[model samples]
Target: MEILERNVEKILAVLSLLAISLIFVYIFKNSDASIINWDEEKVNLNINDKVYENLYIDKINVPPVKAGDVVTITKKDFKLSDNNENLVFRTYGSTIDVFLSGENIYSYGEDLYREGKTLGRGYHIVKLRSLGDKTSDLVIKQRIVEDMSYRWVDFFKFTSSNNIWHEILINNVFGIVSGIFLFSLGAFGNLVYVVLFLITKKNNLHLSYSFATMFFIGLWNCTTSGIIQAITGNYEIISFLEYFSIYATFVMYLFLVALIKKKSGKTKAIDIVKLLSLLILIGATALHLSGTLCISKTIMLFRNYALIVLLVLFYTLYIDYKNQKKYENVLLIGNCISFALIVVHIIIHNFNLTEIMDITNDNLITIAVLVMIIIPLFLYFLELDEIEKYEMQIRVLKSLAYIDKLTGLGNRTSGIAYIMDLIKNGFDYYIVMFDLNNLKEVNDHLGHDKGDEMLVNFANCLNSSFSDDYCKKIRYGGDEFIVVAQFDKVEDINDNIKQLFRVIDEVNRDGEKGYSLSVSYGIASSKEFATTGYENVVKLADERMYSYKSEVKNQICET
Candidate 1:
């Protein structure tokens, strides 16, 4: 019942956070519906510029662009924008060229297309410098690779060079912000995993792989959003990272699940999937780098592969979760959520019916990716907390088993273990055995309570005397106690014995109780008795204690 309640609390907490986020989104969307006016900034490039709000485009299958490419051309007669302003074209896998009054002003990816190389995409910002000022003819020629034709430049934009980044950020705040958040979470998880691994020294590699999976997922998200490419304009590196991150995510996630299953004593069926993921990365990267195929074409293969693997994993984890209550329960939850979101996204994208109940599922991928990482991470921490509590309970039980109820010192069982450990290490130590005097008489005449009090008081004296790092004090039995210590010299034993005697005298000063505590002790040093073995040494100590008790009786008779 308690476990169910804890799980419910965590689920409610996550749902509440999502509700708060939806509220914020609602407020942001409703806050402003007006169009933005950029002319209010100090750099009023649009003031003197002849910026047209619309452009006329002609779709042409054309005289042919290779065999499968799509070519589009647009021509217009209008006044060119101000020389200070620039025409920016945000394009992907498309070769774009601008002509002002029949003279070339800007060209991008033309050589790549000519050389039959993949034109990885980024923004092409063109400078307008004196195109004869009068009504000039503008022409834009474009060629898009067939596989990457989905990403096309939809419109012509003119802005100052300084405002390009500002516009990019304004357009992609959510992507950049969410990307940073996901990446930050991955980093924090890594730090936590490191600390936890150092402390526990147990099977915890799953967390590291899980965090690595999350890191790459965030990298892919941010890079694919085009914000990083817009900022750096290094489309090649950003595109490489985007492809590499998918491969890494696939491999890391497989490893994470495999480790979890292995820990749960499951068979090694997932290793085949792990190998397939690795082969996909290696083969696709080799082909893409060799110009035989584009990485974009491999995305379909990855998606199909991921769908099959996730279904299998979902079924396996679900069965395991139902059959047994284990840590993998959290993994199953994350896996199911991700798979469901992915299936929804696939259906929406394929069927072209993204609008459901007046809401478009544009953020499904982001939500799925974040949910896949966050849910597992949160629930894993909860599982770890429970494991720590179990360990604490075990420690408490062990401590109770080794401790004496009446005296608080170690009991006879613990004393034997302590001495055995010392002998195992070949240490020269001294054993001091103590037997409380007149305990039987006190129990018979003054009652057992007073005898128990005397026994406790003497144990307290022994504790006060032998409370050093190398000393082990134990209540051997009823009215019998022992202190085993590693001392540099026999002289140190005498000093400790004197200290014990001093404490005993102080404890016996309670005359109002009509009783005093007394103990006869015997000392045996391992240095002298080791030749006879440890068992004989203990027997000798017992005999010497009885001899001392006899001497005490004789002295009392003389008095």
Candidate 2:
């Protein structure tokens, strides 16, 4: 029945995830606005013999190009029916000047020959004035400011101003939403861990590293998806964030190493590799900030390095798993999936074969990384739950070991240990030793079970008379019991004993077991027996108890 319930819960969880994913896909698909693909559209371009032209721009092949080279595109037959509709031109990898009937309408980026001006790197959207029934040719003159092995435009899309923004949002909707989800997951994980650390006053490095990794990966997705560019329109900030995200990965790897060390113990080699990765990240950041190296140019190399480091980290975790380290299996599974996705992405990117891979507009790799982060975190939480349950079980077992089964009081071993602990701690306590009178006689006349009832009755009397905060009551042995209590004055102990006797008298009057219960007890104090030690005090209490028992026997004989 328990196994069936668990399976049902698993099925429900899978259904919930599928439902959310379907909803996400549906929303993204519907948000797309109308867009014109230049390659597919019937647009005529007049490119002079100096520049190459292709009927299908998507399949264009071209020669090498350097800075200051100009290429003109003239769409002569294009006409707009709506005069109020604004023209939006989008492209990448070069500075562009748009002209309508030989008049320059908009310009982007610095002059082609400018030395220090930053060149545009990613998608750019320029809005033009209303066409207004003008049959004039639409012309675009693009200057290649960055060196390119192939002189080809990556994207050229034509749309209205409103649709242009909408298209950008639509194109990046999955990334934007997923990035926010990842960020929120990371932030919430961090918040939970921070609260736990504050309450428990202990550090959890594994969760810390996991959250940091997720946060930076989410930030990276946001930047790469063009969402930040759409919102801020700051190329420099976007560019810097790209590098920052990469560096953040390096730091995140270091944290992962720290977590591994905490779980499975450290190795000098792993430590050295972590340090080297940190130095490389720092050096790259420094060079980029100083303009000594272009981050865009070096990003692929850094990614390659990061992939190598990730593989190494995964291998180390595998080794730890082989060594039977706890929770390593979950980490290994998550890391392996992430590693495979990274490998696929690298291959597709380097070969420019995203189309062949059918992953041109997909965020599968991003989702895989999200899974990579989430699975381990989920497993960690499960482990925590198990630990808590195990600890609770241990507490229960320990209590059982120390408690008496018949009377529900501390057993002999625990009672002795308690007194020894008090003596070692130098706490002053009054000790009371008790022995039930005529217990053997009751056991022989009635039964052992009835005698056990008497023992329980006496235990109930002790519990009713003494406060747990100040008193330790134990069923020391057969018919023998002991109590150790702390009191502000010696008279307080006497008063408590008088109260105990009254409780005993009340229980005797009830006569539920058809027999009267009686006890002979002796009291001693830690202060009075300081020179003799607590063990001797216990012996003295035992001797006085026997003496009291004998005196009661003589009174019984006389009666």
Candidate 3:
């Protein structure tokens, strides 16, 4: 009862200390106020001075552990703050067994290995349970199953009640947080884009795919950080996710590239590259899950394959740039950045240079994945803006094709199409053809500008005479205008012509211009000429208009 009460108090104290330490980690990670005693002299696993070397040091040439090597590291009579405190360390691609005084104290990953599975990286927090009073040798035998980027197991200091994840997170919080940010951004962004596409019929699915790729990138980042084991004890599941997300993210990235380049009509290059890389990724995944060959062993191949994809796409982007395609330069810069990082990773891994290594090479990889997802988004927005602008220009050109500039009405082509449409629909309609009385005289006597003004005033009169619901006013040519209207009866057609004459009278009554706007028009109804075509009706209207012109001339002579 007394020991349990003491242990609980110690645990509370350690938790409070870790809480404050986490604040420092977020605010300033290099603060001296640390919860875990990182100093080798006070927090080491060994009571003797021999165990103090390379404890939590960032760069050391500790020998690389190979598969099937059962290396034993023993600590005799290791000092512990209390019986409740636990020993913690990190190992990659290995199984571990701990024996205290020749009795098995803790064992991990053996069952997974027996099942022909790769025991993923583990943050082992071995509990110190033993004869409370006896001092014994703590023997740790680690069997390496695969060679990794960081091959040596690092023994981190002890913490109360298996609370050792804070130390690993403290030094590497930026990459981890960046990973979570990417994951969150991708998840929310994908949901919004997908919903937008489904509901509003907006096609931003390529951006959604890009977001999905970011989601997998974040998953890969979090899974390999070795902090997930502390959060959830499912190392096997996390390990699988770590590798599976790699393949998924890579494939999604390739798919996004193909989607972008597909519109360029030169997709053969990207298609071939994607196909070959896809085949390899699929094969690698099958073998990895089936326990034939682990996916960790195939990362080298895939990364090198990624270089090929980038190289081929580089040529594709160059061609697009030459052709002045939008967003190509942005994507080119992104590809170059990623290509350079991949080169750095390859160089570091090939030479095994610990001098430049920041604990693990995976952090650099997370940045590369971030680059692939984020850079595409910038280009997507640029492309989207350019596409909308192009569409607007097309609409303007189409409008100009059917409109007359001087009269602000439909042109001759529009009148012909409108007349033919009314005839085709079998609608009871009226087609009125009007010719200005003295347009040529106005042009020859008062200059062409006055003639243009008269033409515009008459178009305004036509517009005011009929509502757009069933009327189309067209400036067919100089001094020749057409008005097409649908009406229930010919009486309604006469009423509109009366309105047209009234509007012309109003315009002349204004006395703004020196000349009066006069028009002679002849109307033909579709119902009256069901057998005669629209062209014949228009010809009859033209003949009547000439007769009206003669009547106007005769009345002028009498006046």
Candidate 4:
């Protein structure tokens, strides 16, 4: 049972790799799939039960045709109305033996003259034979013309054989090879790691492996279409398959954008840019499908441009390495190498310089090389020393900027910047201002250390009670804290603060020293001072806080 199951798994894996390889091979083979038009005039028609027709062009450039031959011809749009049967002119290679309706009619030299001429226009399939005892090679071609009678058709001509099909086939083969490698080495490992990571509840590691799998899958598919064209000399199939590969890449690109956006939180501007790029991709695809455009040239450009973007993103990784170093360094290196392989393939394919000697789709195998070799090794080399330096630099800068290290809250400088940004954007938000009571008396009775502890405790309580989504917390000064909530309405701001304060009171009652911490609070809505801006809101909230504090103090004094 185990052996059978293993065999089935192997079969499935091979099939998947084959599928991806075919897709990429198809794309690469049909990079230049546009039709090439050749000019031609009247081809001599020989109706042979036994008849010979000789067709010749003297001065004009025509696709080559000789006497005594059978040819298949096609035009853009022309139909023969004789029984609605499109004409196919046929003749023997050597003998001028012609048969109409399976009955022998005539031979060229014995029964008819070879110099007989018949001219009919639009597109014609003409057969001819030289007036000799020996036979020559058979040639066939398709032609198009405006008017056949006037157009000059020259004598036999030849053209260099097209190698586009050959190149396409080889590319498709390469695609297959690369796909197999990616599936076996990169994606297999990634899949295993993803499943294991998720089972172990390592969400970050799971994310890394999941992304790795997708990236390699895309890589595998993009190259296989090229390999297909390399093997079988079929251009039409290659062109059709290329469309699939491009569509696959479009999907992968979207997935990449979504992954990055998910990590970076909400950024509307970046989302908008990605949306525009997606629209362009869709437009290009639609054009190709409708046969109005062939986007292979554009796709080729995008492959290289995508590499440059990937390189830039790699630098961004280096820039952010410090902050992201705690988990899955291995996955980062894997991603980098996978992207590098794609870049290398583009360089090799575009420049005709990959193998230096023998060229094949196996070059795509380099992605597996990176995943199985480079990434694992890079992970081992990861050190915290550089990251530590970055964090230390950030710490020093934050101290000088607007971080209050004692309570871990934003200080005056950063607080002002945050509020000013909201005001510049012309948003409606609420400002809540508050101050701790009885600090001086507590400091005198229990020393400055106890007073400092009380202040830190109060900051911690506010931090825990308030969420950053709706409110931005700030240490306004000693014994004072402020929160600016950005939103559309004042009631939401008021209700949220009331709920947060109730939670804080509960937390205080749970116990802390002999005395419970208390504060007087006030709120100012953005609507109340739309013309006055953020500074006015701050001033108004502070004034309300002072008034509330005085009233509470008066109540205490009366008691």
The alpha-carbon RMSD values of the candidates against the true structure, listed in the order shown, are 7.6, 6.9, 12.1, 16.7
Which is the leading candidate under TM-score? 1
Candidate 4: worst-modelled 10 consecutive residues by lDDT: 143-152
| Candidate 4 or 1, higher TM-score | 1
TM values, all candidates: 0.72, 0.68, 0.67, 0.39
Residue 416, candidate 2: alpha-carbon lDDT:
80
- Local distance difference test, each candidate: 0.66, 0.67, 0.70, 0.50
Error of 4 at 450 (Å): 1.4
Q: How many pairs in model 4 have backbone atoms within 3 A of each other, for residues 3 or more apart or on separate chains, i.e. clashes?
A: 41
lDDT of 1 by residue, 1-559 (tens): 3454334334433543454356347535643313322221111111112233332211111121232454444334545544236665555566777777788888877787778876675666677666565766555666665354222442245565466655644544455556665566566657765665565554456567766876787777678666677667776667567777877787887887776577556535577778888888888778777666664465556567768878877877776776555555777877888888778766654444423511432356666666666555565556657766996898789789889988788998888888888888788788888898889988998998888877778878887888898999999998888888899887898899899889978877878766878889888788776373667667777788889989999999999
Tens digits of per-residue lDDT for model 2 on 1-559? 3334334334433432454366467656764533432223333343335644434343344344555566676666456543224544434446677877678877776552355554544566555555566677767787765455432454455554465655655666777776666566557657766766666666767667777777777777777677777778866567677667756755775566555556467445567668877787788767666655553355666657758877776767777777745665777787788778778776665555525432343365566566665655555555555766787899799889899988999998888888888878878888889998878998999998888888998999989888768799999899999998988776887788899889888877886677887889888787775373678778878988899889989998999
User: Least lDDT summed over 10 consecutive residues: which range in candidate 2?
Assistant: 36-45
- After TM-score superposition, what is the CA distance of residue 442 in candidate 3 from its true location, in Å? 7.1
Residue-level error in angstroms, candidate 1, position 75: 4.7
Pull out the clashing pairs in model 3: none
